[model samples]
Target chain A: MAINKIVASVEEAVADVHDGAVILVGGFGNIWNAPSYLLTAISKLPVKNLTVVSNSGGFGIEIWGGVFGVHEHDVEVLHRTKQCTKHIVSAPTNPLVVNTLETRYRAGEVEVEMCAQGTLAERVRAGRAGLGGILTPTGVGIPEIQRDKPVIEIDDRKYLVEKAIKGDFALIRAHKADRWGNLVYKGTSRTFNATMAGAARVTIAEVDEIVELGELDPEAIVTPGIYVNRVVLRQ
Target chain B: MTEKFRIDDQTMALRVAKEFKDGDVVNLGIGVPTLASNFIPGDREVIFHAENGVLGYGNICTAGEGSYDLLNAGGQPVEPRPGMSILDHAESFCVIRGGWLDWTVLGGLQVSEKGDLANWMVPEKKIGTIGGAMDLAFGAKKVIVVMPHNTKNGGYKIVKECTYPITGFRCVDLVVTDIAVIEVTPEGMVLKEVAPTWTPEEVQQLTEPRLIIAPDLHEIELA
Candidate 1:
């Protein structure tokens, strides 16, 4: 039988994701690009001890909740519901924000691992490309960041060797996708979603529109279907 | 409370914006650096690159006028200019890591005589995040910093060596502060220009490292 990559529901798309799973959520602190439906669904599940890797913890949190009515659920919902036990993110929150993941971090409720934005994306890319790691000049001298990592010196400059980060599942938002899962993204929303596409064992995309396989222009597709396991329409 | 000695944020931004060459692709870090984008002379066609993904984005829009999909790295809504193009995060950093960016203006908490930068973390405060500052600091052809001359409590930020964690070593080329425009040279900090009310000697008193006045030192132009 021919395989169908389309899932009937977002819940079913993320059904296999359970406790202690390393899941990648894609977005760059913008509500439009974030996988809100997937994130919202994840919040409802009984999953715990999830290590989430993303660019920012969520968008609009600094706005003291969303100024715009676009986002259904920010990543903070997952933290609030106790679905995520740890977060490996770059821009977590502004220090001034009243209620943030930093509060939980201070309480030792959730574990937080900070990664540089470029390093985070590159590490995830490395995971998909089957590379050992990346040697970057970022975070080389920082005691907290470089203390435990291996350092490689090239051309008289020292670089930290960051290992690739692979997720058990990836939840990404895309602008358009075909039945075969070839995806296209819109504007700033494309930040981390396209990079996180294949960096996981099962890459599930939540898209605004799903077209026929041949409908999407080849040049416009950011992620090929080969990297994607399932596609669900955004609510 | 009139403080004639200090330049306002816009003046500081304009001073740094004047350094941009025509056709230069500049990445402006948040705060003072972000303000530089507003002061870029209309005659110069500088492309603004936001690490969030877009290149050639225009000014930050007013609250109701913005399209949520279009935003800068700081998460503020912006309008993309004619030549603007948006790419993914990896490709955006590729522009930085590949040494394609012409210049990047960042804010610094502390800058050493050797140009070592420490802008991301202040351990005393538990909350901090290192975004693309490191990549931009090392990747750009020229790394310039726009910051205050001293801390809020009147402590020097330009130091002999940074007490905070280092972001990039010997990376900063220029320093634009409220009181002075200083250049980081191999020998030491060169005082290029000072605020009109403040003399180079006065600015030197606030700086931790010894300031060497340039031969053609002049006051910052406010016009």
Candidate 2:
């Protein structure tokens, strides 16, 4: 049997996602890096009460369309359509605009669990690496972040113990991928996409180009095929 | 309705830029701190780090010049310089959390006499974005906050205690406002330099905390 993980379409790639699933959406609030097709497909699904973990709660597709001059969806579709019940994010609201997530959060339609960006990354990394948790000094003094969390003193410095964040699915964007799902990224597009690659049980990659196996440079692969469960080429 | 002679935003940024040393790695927050990049001295080589995963990037690109794929922490496209490296978000925070940054300039909502910082949110909004501010606040070797001395309604921002939620405890090292340059010392907030044509008494009148007058206090120097 050949090791082919490439799927036919974005809809087919996310077909197995169910209601109340934990989804890790990639990108740093930019259309170029976001898994727009997968997000659109997920938004069209009947699934409800999703838990979205990302760096931002998204500023919506229209705002990004204005910024990049492209009509692409972002994680905001989840909140706009009322599919997401909770958002575990670092930046949940944009200062310039009142995004969909903020609107929903204010209306008591959605919940938010905010974390520092670095701590969010490390938590996802810990999930992928099968670690228990991490201790850091990022939120030592803030009561809102330190509430009910255990604190340990290391070398006389207080550190908060942040738990790992694993997801049911990870929707990521990549520059290119092989049939076997070996992925490489371009520029800063690699931000959270590369970080959430293997941080979930099922990692689905939406890539710009899909090549034959062994076509990708052996030394240049940012995410090996074993970590990727499926790959779909962008339309 | 009295007209005051406060320094402008660019001049405040220039004052903050003077704190940078050659070969120093600095992370700049959004707003006024981002403006400091434009004022870095020509003779010195300062590496700029963005939380979104680019290091040693050049200046912010004008419209139609840079690609959308390359953006700073502020979500603005920036020029790609030689020796610049792009990594994933995880690796980018490693540079931040690992304490490799020599200085981090952030815009402040409020700073306490104890050097506590509260810039992430205003309590009335009921929603705040943490972003990378908490990490940058606690991780950087030296933290410098730049903002106006008072709120739009003429309320003090540099106070005896921050009423807004704190970003970091005892994290602020220095503060550069529109009217004065204040240093957060072990004893209290020290008034180090005043803006031209502004007196220390006038600055203290708007400030919430009592300021210790530095012996060598002078007018803010951009050079």
Per-residue accuracy of model 1 over B1-223 as CA lDDT, tens digit each? 2345688888888888888788899998877788777777667788999898889888878778887788887677887788999978889999887888999999899999999988987878676778888888878888999898898888989999999978888999999998898999998999998887888778888999999999999988655
Deviation from native of the Cα of residue A185 in model 1, angstroms: 0.7
DockQ list for all candidates: 0.74, 0.88
The TM-score between candidate 2 and the true structure equals 0.97
Q: What is the lDDT of residue A27 in candidate 2?
A: 92
TM-score of each: 0.94, 0.97
- Candidate 1 chain A, poorest ten consecutive residues by summed lDDT: A59-68
Off by over 4 Å in 1: A1-3, A59-66, A95-99, A155-157, B1-5
Task: Give the per-residue lDDT digits (tens) of candidate 2, residues B56-147.
Answer: 88888887888878888887888888879888988989999898999999989999999999998899988898899999998999999999
Model 1: share of true interface contacts reproduced: 0.80
Q: What CAPRI grade goes to candidate 2? A: high
Give lDDT tens digits, candidate 1, residues A39-144: 8888888889999998777643435345654537767777788778899988777544634577777778888888888999999999989998999887877776
The interface root-mean-square deviations, each candidate in sequence, come to 1.3, 0.7
Find the candidate with the highest DockQ and give its number: 2
TM-score of chain A of 1: 0.94
RMSD of each: 2.2, 1.4
